[model samples]
Target chain A: MEKTINLTLKVWRQANATAKGAFESYEVKNISTDSSFLEMLDILNEQLINENKEPVAFDHDCREGICGMCSLYVNGRPHGPDDEVTTCQLHMRKFKDGETITIEPWRSAGFPVIKDLIVNRNAFDSIIAAGGYVSVGTGGVPDGNAMPIPKVDADEAMDAASCIGCGACVAACKNGSAMLFVSAKVSQLALLPQGKVEAARRAKNMVAKMDELGFGNCTNTGACEVECPKGVSIANIARLNREYLKAKCLD
Target chain B: MGTFFSSSIGKKFVMSLSGLFLVIFLLVHLSINALLLVPDGGEMFNNAAHFMALPLIKYGLQPVLFVGFIVHIFYATMLTSINNKARGSVKYAGGNNTKDVMWASKNMYVLGITVAAFMAVHLCDYWVPLQITGNVESTTLHGTEMHDTYALVNAAFSQCWRVALYVVGALGLSLHLTHGFWSAFQTLGASNSLWRKRWTVIGTIFAWVVGVSFSLIAILQHFFYQA
Candidate 1:
């Protein structure tokens, strides 16, 4: 059975980064229940284009959850009402027929809106550029088990590695803190034996860059953990704090 | 050091360190104040208060404690403003509830301001006259002359409104500590799962003990010990 939902979307419309933004209402009719949230936006854009009106501009690359490019503050959450899923994974079934969904950009000093619902997340890229990489030279492909690692450590590292840098943590945080994102990157490298060579430098440099980017301090509110689509834990934040403090003491 | 202190995490580290120091101070303060319950006509209380007033502590530790309080307040105000600005002008218009975060965690600033306001009243009642002016009516205790600090405390707590104020202050401290105790250790690098879980348990108990103990002294003095 094909089910459809008619939603009234109060989408934030901003022409440019410097322009004043406000919520503009549009009615999206006959949206399929199985359509992803982005797909619904696509339908609305198609309607606007057919009517010779300017379409809403949003950022999306792979349309898959892995890309971290699909950024939307659907309703109150970073990725709509769904848990442990990105906006691309959030289907229309989550909404009621007459629901009025509110959408906004990621509101943070580090992430200014480039246009309608499109935020400049280059701050994250800069932070990653700081020290998010291992210092190993490129050569022949190393053996998978060249470095022996405990299963617990490997699993923990993988968990930390799951962060997609979507900026959802900042969006969810009341303080707009990027600790969860920074901590995920820090912990992923800090936990693995291969990345352990420059763990201290990585921790210090990444934290410095994060601070330089004007992100707020973490107060351990744990909102970042709950609203995270990738299920990134604030435990990684604890590890980042540990790593940073250890590095500072040594310095 | 200046650059480090200016950083976001560095600011937080300052807050955590100062908060833990104040927590320790509270424990000592509570124990000293608990002497009010002693039924020896303020003899033991006065003597203990007199020792605390000795020059070594009166000049040395008092200044350090005051600086700790100032630093904590300074950094707290600075961080709160910066964090508020970092959230940007466009506020989240939707509902603001998350399952994992505590209410106290979100409202620590308000709790801190409440506690600070109470401290002003408390200092005016006791610290100013006793520490700064040394005008706290002297009395002899254990064959030595000491400020009748016990009388000051007993007289203050005897008033129902003053007892109510202390209770409110204790409540604010309890809420502040509930998130802060474990959070301080976490910021200081206690990140392991086992230790984090343990700290959460320990932090809650610590908050409860401090709050209940401080409030008990006030309530007890108000109803039972009117001397």
Candidate 2:
């Protein structure tokens, strides 16, 4: 038998970027327990559309959770109440029948709300544009074994690389810091042999760009790590600090 | 260095260094205060306190300690203002995180202010008379004259309210250090996944030990001091 549950959603509503927002309550019935949280929202949108109402707007792409687009502050958590999953990966079975869910946009000076639940995460792009890439001369592909990398280093780098640039860390942080995101970006590169050439500069520029974009400093609270869907460690943050210090003090 | 201090991590670096310096000073201060419980009629504590008042420590280490405190407070203020701006005026209407964000970690500035407020009373009870006003009663032990810091401390502790305040202050200090200790190391790039958990455990133990001992000394002095 298919399991379905009824839910009340106090979804945030706003006409435009400049418009003030508020929670507009609506009842969603018979949402399948197996449906992804975003899909459930899709059902709600379909219902609203049939009723000739302005549907709730949200950001989502690549529902498999790779694109980092679907953002929703579900209840009190950034991605509903699930651990290690984005909104698209969150299943409706996590909620009880007739549960009231309050949805919100990411609230931070660096991430302003554009519409109902869509926030401006362009600050992330700006930080990346500042120094998230390596610049090297074009050349033919080298043999895979040419550069011998440690297995431990490869694993750690992969762990950091898993961050999907979801603003959940920013939304979840009490201080509204983007340190986890910036740190993950820096660490994934800093750990590898190919990225060693521009490690120091990458750390400095990315951090400076983050600060310039109104992101707060890391207080080392571990909140970002716990809330991170990718489970990226704050250890990356420690590494970023090391790299940034090398650029500023040693260099 | 100037350019370094201007960046976000640089400012955090300042906080970490200053906070660690203060952490060390706390241990030293607590050890000296613990001497009051020696059951030796304040002799050991007075001798120790007098040595601290010597020009070598009084003029040298004392000014550096003041700078450590000032720098920590300055950076905290600066960072808090910047963080508030980053958080913006429009607050989250209803949000609650299930993850256990450390209670002290969230309210560090407030805890710091509580400790600072307690320190104000502490300075008035000791530093004002002993260092600035030269109004503290003096005694010559053996050959050298020193401010009777033991007497002043005993007098302050004898009051029930003051002793209670010390207990509260000690708890505040513990809460602050619970986060501040490991956080300092983390900011300095000394902590990792393996070490971050270790530092947190060590920090919590260190916080409680110092806090409980400081309160015990005060309570014992309040009830048993022969002054």
Candidate 3:
């Protein structure tokens, strides 16, 4: 067995919004292929901190793939070479020794770089803010199954709700469009009986907010689905379009 | 403006119409380019090229194609921007690890942008040079500078690397089309009880044929053509 393998990493280093950025190479020695991709980065950051160099700042909350915060574009692919996992879940086993991995932040006008590996995904919040929530007042004591939605609708709603809002769809998009995310959110709620009261308004507000955030349009490239961890259907986008059209034309 | 635009169906209707229009253009383009493979004497290719370049056709139809291109791009841009603003500051967890949605649809915008970028490159390679500079220094078919515009077509596609680029661009276009085609129809009211699954399959096949056919012509000509 080979005891040690060398790797070259070209990580993006931007001190702040005002500073120009460039790629800095670092050598990682003797890494086990079994190590998670983030674990490899942790090893690198530990080495940097020990050497008194400021560690590379990346956004990661849960080391598991559940949190969308661990955003990184590995070798021109959002979230490494693997098909559907987040950067945190990507294992080094997928890569060969001595491979040069190019790591960069999400490139989108809407997703501005906050620092190394951190992007302000506020664009997502605004879309939800636009109409993501149901308009029920507080202190509701309704039963869990008050309204009986169709089984198919319930199942589909569950599917749409599975979207974790990880900006992978945005990062993966060439035009930086967020239709997948917005549509998923809109469809999930709109599918439910509880969400009926404001379905039209919800679709309109969310879509408009999406447009305002500078994300590129969706031309159905499907790269988002190829990269989406949640497997959100492009059908949701169709649903979103339907909802938006209906809401728009009724007046 | 704000009132109706705020509805879900309204957006879907526009997106669907625009998408259908673009799909029609793709079919037309694919059929036209497929003429290059018609075989024997290059008669079909010339006729098709001449048909397209006729003074009436060029003058009368160029403006319409231009408008189609603009509307397709414009609505796509507008819808995307609105979604971004609406979903501000939240991200869904799951990476290549996410087990739910298909990766292709999630990254539609990315693929679209790639196709658009490559389209620009392709247009420059063929359309601009051939149309703007009519001196025709590239490839000449028999004696007359490949009049029938055959010279320009061969010139742009004959190179090995350029052929490779065309293949890659076609891949991007295919990826975009496969997901977008039926999806747009679905949004426009085709998501009925019977035709949804059928259209999805048809859309995928359509994407492959158009994309591969357009790209295959370039590759075959570069590798196997005897001229």
Question: Against the unseen true structure, what C-alpha lDDT does each candidate score?
Answer: 0.89, 0.90, 0.75
DockQ (Cα-based) per candidate?
A: 0.66, 0.74, 0.11
Specify the highest-TM-score model's number.
Answer: 2
TM-score, cand. 1: 0.96
Q: After superposition, which runs of candidate 3 have C-alpha atoms over 4 Å from their true positions?
A: A1-4, A137-146, B1-183, B186-197, B203-227
lDDT of 1 by residue, B1-227 (tens): 56667777778899999999999999999888888888887888888889998999989998899999999999989999989988887898776655668899999999999999999999999889998888788898657878999888888887999999999999899999999999998888775667778988999999989998999989988898884
Residue A50 in candidate 2 has what lDDT?
Answer: 100
Decide which is better by TM-score, 1 or 2: 2
DockQ of 1: 0.66
Question: Residue B93's C-alpha lDDT in candidate 2?
Answer: 71
Q: By lDDT, who's the top model here?
A: 2
> Estimated TM-score per prediction?
0.96, 0.97, 0.65
Q: Which regions of candidate 2 are displaced past 4 Å?
A: A138-141
Candidate 1 lDDT over residue span A185-232, tens digit each? 999989987688898899889999988888888899889999998999
Q: Encode model 2's per-residue lDDT on A95-188: one tens digit a residue.
A: 9999999999999999999999999999999999988887865368878798788999999999999999998999888789999999999989
